[model samples]
Target chain A: MMRALSWQSLVAVLLLLAALFQLPLANVPIAMTAPAVAWTTLILVYGFLLAGIGADTFMRSRLWRGIVLFLCAHLATVFLFTLISDENGLARPGFYVVLAACWLLAWRCVEILSGLQPRSRAGRIILALIIPAIFGAWILIIWEAVTRGLGIPFILLPPPSAVFTKLIFSLSVIAADVNQTIFKAVLAGYLMGCASGFVAAILADRFPFMRRGLLPIGNLVSALPMIGIAPIMVMWFGFDWQSKAAVVVIMTFFPMLVNTVAGLAVTSTMERDLMRTYAAGYWQTLFKLRLPAAGPFVFNALKINSTLALIGAIVAEFFGTPVVGMGFRISTEVGRMNVDMVWAEIAVAAIIGSLFYGGVALVERAVTFWHPSFRNGKA
Target chain B: MSEARGNRIIPVLVMLIAIVAIWYAGTYFMNAPFQRDLDRRAGVTRSSGDLFIATMTQPKPTLPAPHQVATNFFENTFLRKITSNRSLIYHAGVTLSSTLLGFVIGTVLGILIAVGIVHFTSLDRSLMPWIIASQTIPILALAPMIIVVLAAVNLTGLLPKALISTYLSFFPVAVGMVKGLRSPEIINLDLMHTYHASKAQTFWKLRLPASVPFLFASMKVAIAASLVGAIVGELPTGAVAGIGSKLLAGSYYSQTIDMFAALVAGSLVAVLLVTAVDVVGAIVQRRMGARPS
Candidate 1:
């Protein structure tokens, strides 16, 4: 029977069973819910499905099958006991236990699937992407089911669906916030900060005096808490994107400057001699050799700064703002008990920040493709 | 090393001189303009030309006087009653305790999660992404939610604030430790395997030792981040103690000097924490025979 259906089909069947069982059981008396029985049945079926997949590959031993069975049984037992003992009419404890079990099982399944030695490179790629994709999806599914099915308070923990709905409903607001926070504040700050840092790095590299005089102070400034500095910037720049931008510039500048200076100096004496032998001027050597060699390190700083800039802008906005920003919305919404809106804002921020960081990383890969770290695939 | 050391001292001295010079010049040149503005705003009888002349010739106004700030610092930090509202020491104590507590909690949780990921490849693949994704949710956004949620659960206190610190602090530790735990070279792993070393033994001896530098580097970052987290936590709660509360209060009252002083205190604390971490790193490097760069 397992051989007749694909593993995806088996998952679909189990999901159907869970949904079907959820109906009548919804009306069952709290004490007589038999949650454990249902959980055990589901676990056994899921375990069998996993074992069947494993059996078609390297999992040839009964011992391996036994381990899977034992884990599933234990989880089922825990869920059953928790459900049976649940006194709350909410059925949260029971649902949570089952959800946790499902999550664990999903995780284990992904692990096993990825660990399988496929016959081809394409298979390997599929395995790599599939495992994380499946795991992430399962997490969202369980999150949605448990939060919605058991009726957790939206204020406390909104379901993924609600968060998504909020995201859709508030797209315009979120987009405007993204524009204000990321486009206006973060981008401006990042550019000015990075440019200044880069220029300072070059100056520091050129003159020993500047390097000696500035690095320690830069480090000191770097260590200044954003919470401490943000308010000062707001006072100076006046409760707008400018203040947030100023804070980001402070937050991002030192790291970029420090990293670039270090990276510039990383060239070996042999390499320096090679550059000198070419009769290259200082500027020529810097642009042709040192800067190219420093690509990875510079990109590292940029990638790090992407996240740092977002963080600076958000936290800076917390001090004071002009009423339309991701940070302002999030802080205000939370105060107003609109957690779903906060989560939605958070979702937008997360997406933007990740994409920003990832974009820098991708550009780094393309620009620094010849670097040892990238070439060796170590980073 | 000698040149680097000498170079460092020169920068330090130069910075001190530059700061002093700036303070002197700022006090001398900027004071008359400020006082004239004040006088004009106060409706003092002076011709515009006279006001300009007064602005140029007015005695330098008090700009903390360097000595005054020093006196205030000493008064606030030492001679004042420890429980006094004006005492920097009391506020420092409150802020430091929370920072330290949060740092400890955060570091432990980070180490634990990192260890779990290191040992379990599946966790490394699945959980690492989530952990990375977790950072995308800005701490500013998370701070209030955490405070509100924990408050509802009747867990509102030092713990909630520390939790925020932990949230901010843990990411660095986890990322750092993951790098550290994975620092063990393949040859080292092979040597452990040849010695029939258990996973735990291999980890303790090979992976953990190799991870020390990374861990300390991360700790430096974590400590600073934790301090920031604690201060931010103080903001929403309106706690009447700690540097954060002091900053907020000073800002509200427009006590610019007090606000600047509180900022100085926080920055000093962060610098001290980072310097301590650097010292530890030096010691660990010496012990490990890694030798300082």
Candidate 2:
């Protein structure tokens, strides 16, 4: 039986076939003659497309499709690297046609593989990882192709290849910057700010007057931009990580305070009445019921503060710094036209910020496993 | 209900009074160092009562009394011409225009992308992660790069700043709208299909209306972010006008009192912008036949 085909898959297959015979799929305006490297890469790309088509027609299983997609993605990367070496100024119509075809087919493979319902947990996890991996790889492939093909200046927009090279070459510099900003400023500020906020929130809960007084003031103070207070902090604490830490503290404190206070109030009257009937004191009730009830809200603040702390520390470094942090590197390097270094720093920020947020989320999962939102199978 | 409302107001008033008193005390303590230093340098023997008055009334206070900032706000806003570079009103206008422009651009871009993501399942999986990734890269870190790159292209002033604002503001709208567009009941969607509604018609008749509340909520967040973007954008350009420039100038001069006044002014602007959005949201919702929540 002929399996019914979707329109996108059909179009993708047709275009792949068309790419097989197209001569000079891309033209390099900058190069007087097409280099052997470009020709070789193009042939290899076409060859991979042919293989992809073969797999699409012959194989229906998710495993084969996923493996073929990865191979094709790798081929695309090789093609981009070669094109950059050839100094291609612009991509011709044929190049775009082939690119679109490859993209569509890759997307199609991803769609099918994602749709597959793996029976085992391990299989499911593998499928989940494979899907986003392909998706993210395509983004890089597309970005690389566009920038290289258009001959965009490195200063305006550097290719991911250049960015990756910078990241590898300048590992020490990036590591030092991360150590200064994230380890020193972010960690110090996050712990102190969150601890103080949590303590203050508990105290506020015990005193109605403090709760009423503090919340409104916190709300107003939270709205004050970091820029306004950062220079002042520098004035007070000197131009080191301490000032940045102060900025982070101010940025982070109110959010935790507000969220924790709200979380503490979330225990319903019925729960309190039940606790009273059980003859539990405030401390016992708080430890057993109220604090546990507040876990999700407290986690929400922690997650929010993770990003805020990084942002506050980095932004504060813009005003005053010891020339060793991410923000300082970016500001100073941008002036020197070293856009690649800035992007490398950005990549570092993205990775660390993501890991920090992920770590908090993982902890939240463990702590708030009983939250209604976590009732689904996901952890 | 009225009694409960009155009870709540009493605590809030008491809290406000207590805070103001604490603030005055804090100012007295913080500004004393400068006052004491001045007194020592001038070899002036001042009484404790006179020192307290000196701290509160210093022209360049280390920590300005609330009344001092208020007086500065009044004088700078009303005494100076609105067009003068010295006036806070003038600087605020520059910041506000860029903020408004950026907010509009970001809102439009966000809605368009959200529609695309909602319509195309592939884009939802692929593009959403990148969008989220874009935000996690601190915009402050990117702001300088954007300013320099745009300057190379001979693009400057409002457009560049507005673009930065767009960068900051678009995420909330896109994220909120995605959730909002998908918020309609499945039964309602099925009913639309039973009526043989086309995709466009269904989107227009059901999804768009359902997303209004979400759009407004996200707009509030977007507007505030846009303001921050506008301020950060001004910083990189060394712009002569804007609330950001005012802050920078104050810091450069070590005029702590003036810096605090500018900070207060900036916060007030943010609050006003959010309130304005709320008012507009209420008006739009009322006209749309949705009962006020």
Candidate 3:
């Protein structure tokens, strides 16, 4: 099994090799009239076509045949390069040749790997994990290759390597920004906003008049553009985390209120009747019946608010800020022509937002384990 | 039912009345002190009694009374804009062009990508997560980078700002569409399969119609977001026209009323655009026989 070179595995290995070669080898002076056809790229394309051909030819053991075809195809490409190009180092299609090969090889690997039908649970899991990782990595590869290979200016779109380097170098500044935006402003505002929304929802539910009066007001508030509100919040709260938090609160409050209201209503009449038969009052019924029923809706609000809070904080920072925040860094750095620094801020935001969303989801799973959606593993 | 309807109308009316009453009281009580501060800052000589009189007689406070804003809006849009600078129509035209261009681009790209995802399961899983994750990186952060990158590539023009609008607007469309496309009832899908329909046929006859509601709903959101994107695009780039530049200019000059007026204009544009979508949605919904209650 290990000895067998499945077309995807072969392509992956070849691309890996091509990427390694892309760095220093191309810089070596070679005199050739036309840049040598991107040999590596051609080989990978050949591999892809061969695998396709194999899939058509071998009906029962197509996978195995596809693997063999890919290996053979790449080998033929390498052999052709040796034959057509001079050994005297006359032509240096060097890095371009390698990059082309790497890209084609990577693409073929993705196609082949994505085509495979997983036969086991672990196989499915691995395939699920691997395919996206490969796709994302290739995007980064293309980004790195295009920027470095073409010598694209760093101030424009910095190479991925440069972004990573900036990520390392400006770890402290990035961390401080993250702390200011995510920790102090976003988290605080998110908590306060969500809590107030939830409380207001409960109050609205309790008072018939409030429900009739407030829901429309909530809708209007939700529709108020963040751009309009953020500056006003800055004016009201001063230029600090407090102002940003106010904006977050305004942005997040409506979603939570709407979702929680809808959630509290999720308890069916049958369920409510059952609670009534048990001699439960409104609060008792709410705690026992409606709250649990509302779990999914509340969780939905939390998930939505995670992203909304981040957005509110960032946009609020644009209006005015005390210097150290994610939004401040992103806006200021772009002005300074520090594209890599901007990318670093973005990477931090992505990771933080993902973790925040994932945390809410995880808590939802734990709390609502008995809910049919979670129990059946549907969502 | 009539009682419930009456109950609903009453609350709405009361809320409106209460809001107006508060505004009136705030104007009456808060107006004097606010004007005194303004006069003090402006180095105008006035006794406390004179300040109160000035506050009452002053055409409008710095914040502009609601009536003043309405009159300003009419004067700028209808009366003046038929001629000069600070014309609401002129600025709106600048902003609207970018918004519409961005909306068209974003919608097309979103639909194409969504189709790709719907057809391929692997692409669905892999692409959907990234698409969702893409939004996590705030557009505010991405906008300047996009501007700078495009500038370096010698691609600065109206198109760049429009492209920023497209970037911001497309995500909602893509996500909304993915849901819409996947929303075909299982029985309906099986029925299509029974008829031996091709993939394209099934898509056209069933999924496309099913997605109309979702698409229009998202278009409302996408259009609003696109307008915002165009405005924000104007801000960093120092674009001479558009509502965003107007707001920035207003802020820069401490012309609070001008800032507010521009904001009102922008909000009106957004509201009008959204209302237009809503009307179209209603028509579509009626045509599809899914009219709202």
TM-score of chain A of each: 0.76, 0.90, 0.75
lDDT of 2 by residue, B6-110 (tens): 776777788888878998999999889888999999999899999999999988776789898888888888899999888989998999999999999999999
CA displacement after TM-score superposition, residue A276 of candidate 1 (Å): 0.7
Task: Return the interface RMSD of the candidates, in order shown, one decimal each.
Answer: 2.3, 2.1, 2.6
Per-residue lDDT of model 1, residues B1-293, tens digit only: 99879878997789778887777565445555676678879988777666545543433333334544555567677788989988887887788888888999999999999999998887777678778867766766677778887887788768888988888889999999999999888998999999999999998889998999999999999999888888888877765788888878866765656666777778888988889988988997898899667
By lDDT, the candidates rank as: 2, 1, 3
Kindly list the per-residue Cα lDDT of model 2 for residues A227-273, writing each as its tens digit.
56877787778888999999888888999999999999999999999
Give candidate 1's error at residue B144 in angstroms.
Answer: 1.5
lDDT preference between candidates 1 and 2, better one = 2
Ranking by TM-score: 2, 1, 3
Candidate 2 lDDT at A47 equals 75
True contacts kept of each: 0.55, 0.39, 0.36
How well does candidate 2 score on lDDT at residue A122?
Answer: 97
User: Best by TM-score, which number?
Assistant: 2
lDDT of 1 by residue, A46-131 (tens): 46544434443334553463345335434543443344233323443434444444454455565666466777879766766665
DockQ of each: 0.53, 0.53, 0.45
Against the correct fold, how does model 3 do in TM-score? 0.82
Q: Which prediction has the highest lDDT against the true structure? A: 2
Clashing pairs in 3: A7-A67, A31-A90, A32-A90, A40-A101, A41-A101
